[model samples]
Target: MARHVLLAGIIGSTAYGLAGPGSDVDRIGVFAVDTVELHGLRAPRESYVTTRPDVTLHEAAKWCRLALGANPTATELAWLPPDLYETRTALGDDLVALRRAFLCAPRVRAAYLGYAARQLRTVERRLTGPGGANPRVAKAARHLARLVAQGRQLYRTGTVEIRLADPEPVRRFGERVAGGDLAAAYRLLAEAGDDLDRGRSPLPDRPDDEAVERWLRAVRAAHLAVA
Candidate 1:
């Protein structure tokens, strides 16, 4: 229950303002120890709060043949700022190997770009262009497109840097909605926009189409490499 609540909080708080012309990916994880292994001297490998940076949880996931290579969050956490987490156990070694396993050559770049393009096309035809009423949908679309750029950066550099910080971005997105800055508010009085459209998104008056396309290419290339 706690884990679910935490995940929801992260998503709900950041999902709105975190976008651009596309949506954003919200990644998270949870780990727990086993009860059967906790017999007398043998304790299940327990996760605990670590003395890290802005991150709050850091635990070494024990690497078993069945468990090691499939854990994406475990592998990703290893690359966070040193202050955020630390892992020197045998399991950590397996995770390092898994990173190499998930990466492909340059082909992943095309896949990510294709994925973002599909999304943009879908939104243009269905949501943002004609009769769509989702106030923040355009911003969400922008975020998704830019993420393609962030992903490409990851692939070329072999590093993942989180752009959407918590709380602030989300709140700003909501504030735009509260201010009635959506397409639906176009005809309302400037002062009346806030009262009439209480749940709108506040994207820029206009997002540059070229910027969205370019960002998608850069981000897509990088996302594939973040094992």
Candidate 2:
């Protein structure tokens, strides 16, 4: 069956306004499977990832699951700026409009900080491992900072800010951490923890699962109609 992409958008360093020379242009998207395929004896693939163009397209149901869990990378699709979007169907627009339904305090805090922990490990490895100054480490450090800032924004304002207002500071921080200053990375992470602990956020304690279910039903219905 032909895959139908409902939404696709530029993400990663480019979306955050932190891309440099030779940076990979990453794109992520959501696609719908025919409703009938879901009942097949063999389950259809839920995700398609290609490195040639650095794109990942998730099945609609899978995308909803990840977003509902506050997966930082997955949630980016729902909050991308208009220009960053490469494709947006009517359903895609609806999904974007309902992004707030997927956010919750506990999941946001856990997912962001949990992803940051992985980046922290990368920073630590760069500090002690050979080739400490490799560009990937710098990228990881930058992502570490980005995740914390984005997470904070979502929790504090109930809105996601994809592009950083001041990206130079994040770049500088990455450089510092990649240059063997693990303490700098730790300090920033600690501050993020503090904010999550003390911040009075506008987000709810639980996500609006009913709204997500309604949207997913719409997606399935749309696919079935076309089929």
Best by lDDT: 2
CA RMSD, predictions in order: 16.5, 1.3
Question: What's the lDDT for all of these models?
Answer: 0.35, 0.90
lDDT tens readout by residue for model 2, 34-91: 8888887999889999997899999999999999999999999999889999999999
Query: Considering summed lDDT, which 10 consecutive residues are worst modelled in model 1?
Result: 1-10
At residue 6, candidate 1 shows an lDDT of 12
What is candidate 1's lDDT per residue for 13-114, written digit by digit as tens?
A: 133235434433443323323322334486544343332212233222232111123222333443344333333333333333334333332333434444
Model 2 lDDT, residue 154, Cα? 86
Off by over 4 Å in 1: 1-27, 30-101, 128-130, 164-227
Candidate 2 residue pairs in backbone clash: none
